[model samples]
Target: MTDTQEHTWGERYADSLMNTFGQPKLVLTRGAGAHVWDTDGKEYVDLLGGIAVNALGHAHPALVEAVTAQLGTLGHISNFFASEPQVRLAEKLLALLDAGPGKVFFTNSGAEANEAAFKLTRRTGRTHVVAAQGGFHGRTMGALALTSKEAYRAPFEPLPGDVTFVPYGDAEALAAAVTDRTAAILLEPMQGEAGVVTPPKGYLAAARTIADEHGALLWLDEIQTGLGRTGRWFAHHSAGVTPDIVTVAKGLAGGIPIGACIGVGESGTLLEPGNHGTTFGGNPVACAAALAVIGTIETDGLLEHVTALGQKLRDGLAADPRVTEVRGEGLLIGLDLAAEVSAAVTAGALAHGFIINNPTPHRIRLAPPLVLTQDDAEAFLTAWPAILDEAFEGQS
Candidate 1:
């Protein structure tokens, strides 16, 4: 296709779609594994993996077969009735957590999962939640209230009130803010939207202790870092603390749009009858897709692959002096640039037939598919120097 053809689609998209996402970067036609082809037939290595949602990569046979088979058999059966896949998925998630007895409430997205958790916290007879600054939970009103970003929160004021924000990774700050009145102390094992910022060692353990001290629920939003993205079933696994509440989505269903809010131990009984509900929450097809994703991760040994590849990518990317820092675990990688050229770097990367993301002016994040090949990783590493050269062409 010609440039005009692409421009026509862009114009049509602007007219037809909402302006929430600004503009579509490319008119992607199809994808296989870690590669995608644009309408122009240009192939690019997909490093963002649909913003960390495509755990098994594009069009994996397991995910495709599971979704197709389930849809053909039984697709949507509202929450009024239960399905085998739904119950099995809930059990699988609990087994993965291995955090004693727990109950799962399914949703269609991460925001909905956090919303359910927010309401569950209210069941404890408290409304005050102390969430860390720089944490990105979700965009729903309740999740938005838990998020500390002023810009995202400012647009919708009078949000569920009494949510306190404290500096991330600071045990003293968290301890000072949480009290008996606090219902939950929410933290992301690793801040994804905030350029994949990671907390200090023992930060989550500290948060667990603080929450316990105040009798508050420890809620970890593992939306971005969970499901093998961090080389573990859950990012909080490394901290060795059992949280009362856990919210997960993103890669849960390998891009089939599923989220879960898991309440542990006594917290599971807080939300009794007539508490909350969803129409399309636990549909059989989505549940099957999630089960397939988990099965593949285990059978294919993708967690070990993610751990090794993540380290390689981090090391290779950090070889350049322009890269000031590298953070995150497993396939979720983020690096800082010495200069404010992340936009230029992203553009340069695209021109070189690789897709990357610039979350901030000086930060780039890469959450590639767990199935990303060693060849693709080497390709990106080999092109790293030249890409930076183009991005920093006119810089000091």
Candidate 2:
């Protein structure tokens, strides 16, 4: 297809699709490995990795085979019956979390998974939840209440109230806000949507101590940083603290839609029968895809690859003077630009055959696939200075 045809499709997209996400960036037709081609056949390295959802990269044979075989055998079974893949995936997640005797509630997306967790917290016989500023749980009502972004929560006022927002990474503020009345304390091990912001050392451990003191459930939103994205089974692993509740999605199924709310120890039994339910939450096909993703990560050792490549990319990206700071772990990287040129930088990267994200005016984030090649990383670093130059020039 030609550029003109691609432009025509973009117009059609504007006409047909909802305006929630604004204009489409590119009309992507297909992807393979860590690369994608737009409708016009323009090739680009996918540094964002479908916003960190494509764990094994595009068209991974393991993911494809699993989804295909499962669909052929049995596709959607309502929550009335049990499926092998669903139970197996649940067990696998528990093992990865290292949480003994937990329960799992699967959902179709991150927001839905968070919704399930939110509902589970309600069963604690308390109504108050304490979350952190700059933390993003999801867009749903219950999850939105926990999210601290005023822009996201403003239009939808009168949200489910009794939620408190505290400064992230500040154990003191968290301790002050959380008390015996609090039902749960929610946090993201690494704040992903906030430009991959990392918390202070020992913050998660402090949260665990505080939650325990108040008899509040500790919940970590690991949707963006879990399942080997942070070079471990979970980001909080490095902190060596176990959360009472953990929400995971966005790579759980490697690209297939799946999310899970896991409750550890006694918290696992909080949501009893008839407390909550979903129609298509634990679909067999999605569970099978998740199993394949977990199996591949364990067998192929992508975690080590992500760790080494991430360090290489971070070191290289920071070598440029325009980068003020670099943060995050593994493939989930965020860098601060010297100026508010992240939008221009992202545009310039696309023009130079790279895909990136600008979550804020001055923050450029990269959550590339775990399977990204070293060659691709080197190429991006090689082009980094030029991309910065073009972006700054555009700003001027």
Candidate 3:
């Protein structure tokens, strides 16, 4: 069954799908907890966790049940009338962020979340925004403007303007870039796409001070680091600075696709009615899914679990001489190999019943679900050397 289906599915995917994402690496059939079964019934530990979107692993009972129940009850209200889940989810995001007096603007993804936040910043009557180098907010026009990658920006020229890029984790650079005309200073508490680059200590606090000094809003993109993914409700919490605007998505709905743009204090009321809108932003099902994701996080005590498991993973991965360094917190782990075999390592892991990501030439990223087990961590640790051996031999 496996052999017969594998070849056919692979061929069909190549023939039918767009060439944008290269090839369909695997046609996954089903998932449960931290594992997924491919079209050919080969199972792999999904350490990537849908690129940190699957907060509750795959097909968690609570997520399925909540989404199912909400869809049946009140699925879409067209944004003309709000539902319980929408309001509750917004309030929940504010509470988790622990910022006082905020409002949430829902979106379908991280890109849209930034779009909404970008629009809100315009309401400050200032057009300028300062963001960090090595930052990735999203790919939409507005968010892409804030993103610093030259290749991504060069192709999509004439993006929405009045944007400046400065070095990340340098408060002095940020201060130099910002001014009274700046509407907001955008940052990621941890730059995930830059291979899990954690900012220097006191950076967020410094941003907060700088924003205040220049009468600009401090905006933090927590899309990749929120919802206990970093062993905290929001990664900025560890920095102990309050950001006026926060964008979140990724793991909020356990793969259901939802994002929120939160504006704190006076920033919450910056966008008046008719300032911006969305079609499916705060749909009930998505909010219910987010509720279920957050509920499960609290019920499972997964925060402590992630913190403990992360230390274990970092220690284990760093023990390998081939692994030069390990970075990130909680389940958002990244490591740099001594050689440029990240692509080979990614392929080797898939062949060895594990799924991980190679975000760069020399970097491997592991963002397993909060539900990833001690045994899975230990298994990966035990197989680290063998995986490296295979990667080197295969790529050599």
Candidate 4:
């Protein structure tokens, strides 16, 4: 395949697919490890890791084998019946969370998981939810109501009301907004969509205290930060606070479509038999993929690897004077550019065979796979200056 072939595929894609994502940047054909090849056969290191969903990278042998083996035996089954993988995966998630005696509601995506949690909060007889301003939960109507982005929420009006938005990382503001009537205080331990913004120290603990005082559920949305993306089973683990409800997806199944809305302690029983349901949420194949992802992360020591490599990448990326600030933990990294050139930088990086993301005008985010090699990180670092130079030239 050549550039001409890629262009042809792009045209075909435009004709066949909806333009929800604006335009196809590349027609990706195949992937292995942390690398992918486009229709034109151009190889690139996937530093964005499918927006933090590919925890084990692409086509990992363990993930493939698990899915294949599960599909061979039992694949899809209605929620009326349970399978071994589904039950086992739920237990495994509870064990990993270290939250005793919890219940899990499986979903197909993060938005669905958040929606499950949102409904669970409603069971407490309160409708008001206090969420952080810059935090992003999901795109569904229920999750969208909790998301504070005016642009995303504006177009979809009359969203489930009684949701209040407060400034993120501000414990004072969070404490003020949450009241006795608030059913839940929703937050992300570290904001992923707001360009990996981590809250101020003790903010989560403060939220817990406030929730306790107000009798509100403390719900942490770890869709992007959970399942070892942030060097821990859950990023909120670093804060040493136990949330009543936790929503996880993104990397939980290592590219397989699976999400879990876990409620701990009393909150676990909020959603009774009649409260919620899903047809394909806990399918055998997805559950098997999730178990395999967990097994691989433990066996390969990927958590420690992510922590070390992340620090190295951050130090190297921050060494460039063009980067004003760098934030995030483990493999989820975000850096601020000296200028609003993130769009040009991302385009330049793609041209240089490195994939990155621009979450905001001045922010560049990197959520590479846990399996990313030191060589790949070093290669990106080596190309950083030149990519910047090209992007700056484009701006000029």
Candidate 5:
């Protein structure tokens, strides 16, 4: 591998692909477990886990085998027909939720899942939705409308309207914002894009009660926090609240591209026939891949592993004086630096053969694979101080 190998590929990517995500970080070639190799033959420990998508890490045998077997048998079928894997995956998700009698609408990504949930809210004859400030649902029109970022929403103005944004973790503000006309109250159990910000204790419960009082549906967007990412089947489970709707993706299929919008009890029936539809939503391969991920997590006891590893990582990260705060559960961790140097820290980590993310100027977020090894974690911790020193070298 040479500079030409990576540089030439970067040029080709710029020429052939849309510039939505800016320049490619690295021309990655292959991955195994929590490590990936670049086109330049450099190996990096993937601490970001494909932005929380690769729950089982790279090239997991279970996911690959499930997808290959399913595709070999029945790769795809139209929504007009059903598949066993699709039905079984839905049933498994509902059983894990334990919220009693729910129906699932599968999609190709989290944005589509949120889009389906948004439409479901409209079926209640109400247009207004109360969403939390600093909350991120997705980039699609409906989900973007619910999102509170002006930069993201300004460019896509005229997004579906009637969505109200209230301060997160503020139960009073949330209660005041909702009305009988409010169709739904959408929230993230833990705000991931907002630097893995967690709401106050009982905030979700408060929102649930508020939704009940207003006769509005409680919709929890677990796209980044669900499916054992937070060491629980769902992040809201910790709050002990049963939401009317839940949207999940990212790691649902361990990077197989699948999302689900689950509606509990009577809310499941709201999306009447033809209210919503998807072409590749319940493709057999994707469903089978998701089933395999769920199975692997259970069999491997990854939930406990994530919980313990998260605490270890958090404690080690917070040991540094430059780290102001650390927040998150399981593998979805976020830390704030003393200065606005998260970008420097990210680059520094990469230079040290590790991959991390800077969601904000001062915030570093880590959603590593559930299968991240203790040795890999210890390696990062041992290198943490040097990475920070390099990042803060020139800072005054």
Candidate 6:
């Protein structure tokens, strides 16, 4: 947009909207490929990729076509008459998991997906859910009960109950906490919000075995890590475990709001009719968008692309002494700084025409679009030390 249009947006945004996310960094006007332009015509290499939602990057033709065609033909039909795209998305997701005999319940966001799974666990004739500390489930009441962050939970108290917290990636603690009374053990294969922490080898297998021994369902939340973002359809697949329930969203629809809770084996049938219902959960447009995303991933071999690029990024970032550690697989990477300079780094990156996330004081996270190119990753690497220098320049 022109300068006048940009200023108008700044004024209007300040006048309206809540202060929940602080001041708008830039009024983004358009996006394409790995870049987005703000209203002021400044462009940024979107390393964070809208918190990992833009898997195919911005304005990919396949995604746009799928969404447009589906919207033109059939849009929101409610949940009474099932849409082809919705059914196809479920079938496609099941195929990706390679888990048999599963049923899916769709929602509009990751949290809602978790919300559906939370209630589904309750239907297993058990009310207890065991989750990991430093885990992020979601913000809604039911999902929030399973989330571990005190700050996010404290403000929304009196949440749905029967949740127990244990240390993440600790199988022994999970085994001890999950009794027969527990309906499910929910986990993120790689902790996204807690700086991309992956569990030790065999941790998920152990969790699966423990759940089996206790007759509790094993649930994997792949909201931030699914849809080929981590070089696999689900990050837990690397653990070689078949979880009874899996909740996915985020990149599922390549930015279209969509989420799903799928239960495998007999666990799929817990939620009976009238148990839960949503007016706009399985809308056609969202499902079509997801189908396009999946198709593009397969056709473009984006999974392999992510694996290669992620390693390049990790290797480059870890070469700096100030970067204490880099943890993650594929494009979902997180790094620890030598000092509590993550916030400064994030601000510095933005100023340098790049985008990243500071999930914790001493840690930075990057869930860039799986389609992030080698050139982009290399450019970031070239700028890495300088970014850190800028971040550290004025520190106390």
- Give each prediction's root-mean-square deviation over alpha carbons: 0.8, 0.8, 1.3, 0.9, 0.7, 1.3
Clashing pairs in 3: none
Candidate models: Cα lDDT each:
0.94, 0.94, 0.92, 0.94, 0.95, 0.91
Question: Runs in model 5 with CA error above 4 Å?
Answer: none
**Tens digits of per-residue lDDT for model 4 on 1-396?**
767777788888889999989787887889999999987678999999999999999999999999999999999988999999999999999999987889999999999999999999999999999999898999899999999999999999899858999999888988889889999999999999999998888999999999999999999999999999989999999999999999999998989999999999999999998899999999899999999999999999999999999999999999999999999999999999988999999999999999999999999999999999999999999999999988777777
lDDT of 5: 0.95
Best by lDDT: 5
**Candidate 6 Cα deviation (angstroms), residue 278:** 1.0
Give the TM-score (vs. native) of candidate 6: 0.97
Residue pairs in collision within model 2: none
* Full ranking by lDDT: 5, 1, 2, 4, 3, 6
User: In model 2, which runs have C-alpha deviations exceeding 4 angstroms?
Assistant: none
Q: Give a tens-digit lDDT track for model 2, residues 1-396.
A: 877888889899899989999988898989999999988788999999999999999999999999999999999989999999999999999999997789999999999999999999999889999999999999999889889899999999889858999999999999999989999999999999999999999999999999999999999999999999999999999999989999999989988999999999988899988988889899999999999999999999999999999999999999999999999999999999999999999999999999999999999999998999999999999999999999998878
What TM-scores do the predictions have? 0.99, 0.99, 0.97, 0.99, 0.99, 0.97
Task: Give a tens-digit lDDT track for model 3, residues 320-363.
Answer: 89899999999999899988999999998999999999988999
Candidate 5 minimal-lDDT segment of 10 residues: 1-10
lDDT string, candidate 1, 260-370, tens digits: 999999988888879999999988999999999999999999999999999999999999999999999999999999999999999999999999999999999999999
**Model 1, CA-based lDDT:** 0.94
lDDT of 6 by residue, 336-383 (tens): 999999999999999888999999999999988877888888888999
Assess candidate 3 and give its TM-score to the true structure: 0.97
lDDT of 4: 0.94
Q: Cα lDDT of model 6 overall?
A: 0.91
